[model samples]
Target chain A: MAIAALAGFVGALTGLGGGIIITPALTLLFGVDIRYAIGATLVGVIATSSGAAAAYVREGYTNIRIGLFLEIATTLGAIEGAILATAVPTSALAVIFGTVLLYSAWQTARPGPVSAAAAAPDPLAARLRMNSTYPTPEGPRAYQVQGVGYGFGLMAGAGAISGLLGIGSGAFKVLAMDRAMKLPFKVSTTTSNFMIGVTAAASAGVYLNRGYIDPGLAMPVMLGVLAGSSLGARLLAAARTKVLRALFGLVLVFIAIQMIYSGLKGAL
Target chain B: MSRDGGARRWTDERIEKLVGNLLRAGVLISAAVVLVSGICYLWHAGTGAAEYHFFHGEPSPLNSVSGILASLRTLDCRASIQFGILLLMATPVARVAAAALGFYLQGDRTYVVVSLAVLAILALSLSGYWVR
Candidate 1:
């Protein structure tokens, strides 16, 4: 129980790959069932989303409009993903999901700069008026969103993966918003925070209907994650971004390797 | 980069006002619901009719008729319908809130309408009638 809380605390501080971390720890270290671990992880996802979103909303960091708009695609895609997961064979899905997680980890480890050129405002971005600014040491600077359509499409895909794999798509969503849409890093992160809950909620309902939710497992995870995420939110302002990002990247790589190993072992 | 642009600088004073309004509204609505629900629960508990269980399967004292009645009255299926309605309403509310917050934070309204539209869709989807 203490371990779960500590893991959740660290996970929340780092944008929640904690469940991914904890699942292995629980199964390998504590000998809990994988099924139970996954169930608890889902609850943790919800708790983290809710806890982080409320603070982000209060702080005015989240782009609620964009987040809400994109949620339509994500929510629908999540339902479809949940449905597909049940229909497919477990082993086949495990191999595919494991590969995707590895690819995602690799991509996250080497994030790129937001834009190459201070080019003219993208026509689509200008038309949609999808440009905004934020506080900086230099002063408030405007950023224009590019490739919103592409970003939304990617979010839908990521949402489906989230539902199918029981992993929060924060990293994927952040990637899409940051890389494809050209949103500022802070805005992308906060907007992703706002939308993840809705995406998780969509699939969570389907999972509940399918009897995937076990109350006993969910209770402890949810409570622990809720507490942890709240604490993490408090620390966001004080924490150093460079150090956090490095730690986050390392954690993702480790989890991806673990997932690959587990998948191969299960197949064998 | 222009002379006109120099005139338009981000001001914390404007942002604070917008955030204050949103906080006030959110608090007002959330408090109302909590208060009403609390009253209903207390009334049921006093009457020995309302009943509920805690996480560990312990029977709560308010599991009698009054308890059930209060729950049904205060938070019945109709409440879900109402929540769906509120969610729909909240999209625009969220948009306004976002716009207000964004304006306060950045002196811009880039996502106000976009946020409201999303809320509207969420409300429609969650309405239950649509799902049925």
Candidate 2:
């Protein structure tokens, strides 16, 4: 529970989910099965994502239209991925998890990403009426959405990762919306937060049904994450998070290496 | 971007606020249920060794809603925790369903369909009607 709270606090500050820390920690430190770790981490992921989204949505940073549209792809992919989770070899899953963790560390260690607003709206986006505005110091500023097809495809991939690994995959979601679809960074981040809950819910249902969700472990993690993320959000404005994010990234790198080593040696 | 941009923005804000409040309520209620039930669980089984190193899936009854509800009648704390988790899962489904209704009211037929499609997938998963 303490580890969960710490993971939740750091993950919220870094714009990730507790799963990245929770899963590896459970497997390596506590001797929990990888599948059970994933199931419980997923519960924490939903709590943090949905809890944070409540604040983000009210602040007008969320793009509900884009979020809902992308969820069609995400939900479909999540169910497929959840089904695959039960069938995939545990070693292979560990290796994949480690590799993804490496990628997440790289992403976090990098400098903050700039928004990729489009010069012109994609015709498909315009036709679908997916273009929208976000609030700014000046006023509500209009931004065009582009690469709808590519963004949708990436969102589906993000969902698959979320289900298979039981992580929020928020970084990938931001990559889809900000880098692919060219929404503003704040818009992408908050909108990704909004979509995370739905995407996780889709796979969580399958996990629950398949008996992957053990309530004894899941409930405490959920409560811990919810409490930690809420406090993290409150502290965000006052906290100098640069050093903290870099430190968190370094920790992920260490965890990733250990996970890969364990996977290769079949110690898991 | 369009002539009705201002009106659309207003509607979006209202809907966003409503969605925000709804999500907050869901999280709070879920947390409360989980907290209460988790305490009961620890009280009953705190001294037992945790059996999570192996990946045995849950029992047949605990995996389904009907079974969980039945367990709750006997004051089984584990089932109560599952019930809370069920509520947590349902929160997002409710959000999607509300969005579908909102879009329908807004007359954005395309997004309404889009939201419904997502909701359908959620429904299938919750019902355990999908491929095992």
Say which candidate scores most in DockQ. 2
Q: Give lDDT tens digits, candidate 2, residues B1-132.
A: 553564476487787888888899999998999999999999999789789989999997888777888888988999999999888887888888888777766667788789889989999988888754
lDDT of 1 at B121: 42
Residue A50 of model 1 has an lDDT of 54
Query: Which one wins on lDDT?
Result: 2
- The C-alpha TM-scores of every prediction are 0.67, 0.89
Compared with the true structure, what per-residue lDDT tens digits does model 2 show for residues A128-211?
877888777788998889999999999898888788878787767876886678787667767887888898888888888888
| Candidate 2 off by > 4 Å | A100-115, A235-259, B1-10
Candidate 1: tens digits of C-alpha lDDT, residues A1-268 = 5555665566656665356665666566755555555555655665566556566565555665467657767777766676676566555666666676667667666755634336455677666555666665667677777787898899899788767766676777877887788776667766776576666656655554444444334544555665676677778656766666666667667776776777667730
Model 1 residue B102 CA deviation in Å: 12
Every candidate's CA RMSD: 8.3, 3.2
Error of 1 at B105 (Å): 19
Model 1 — interface RMS deviation? Answer: 9.1
Candidate 1: how close is chain B to the reference, as a TM-score? Answer: 0.40
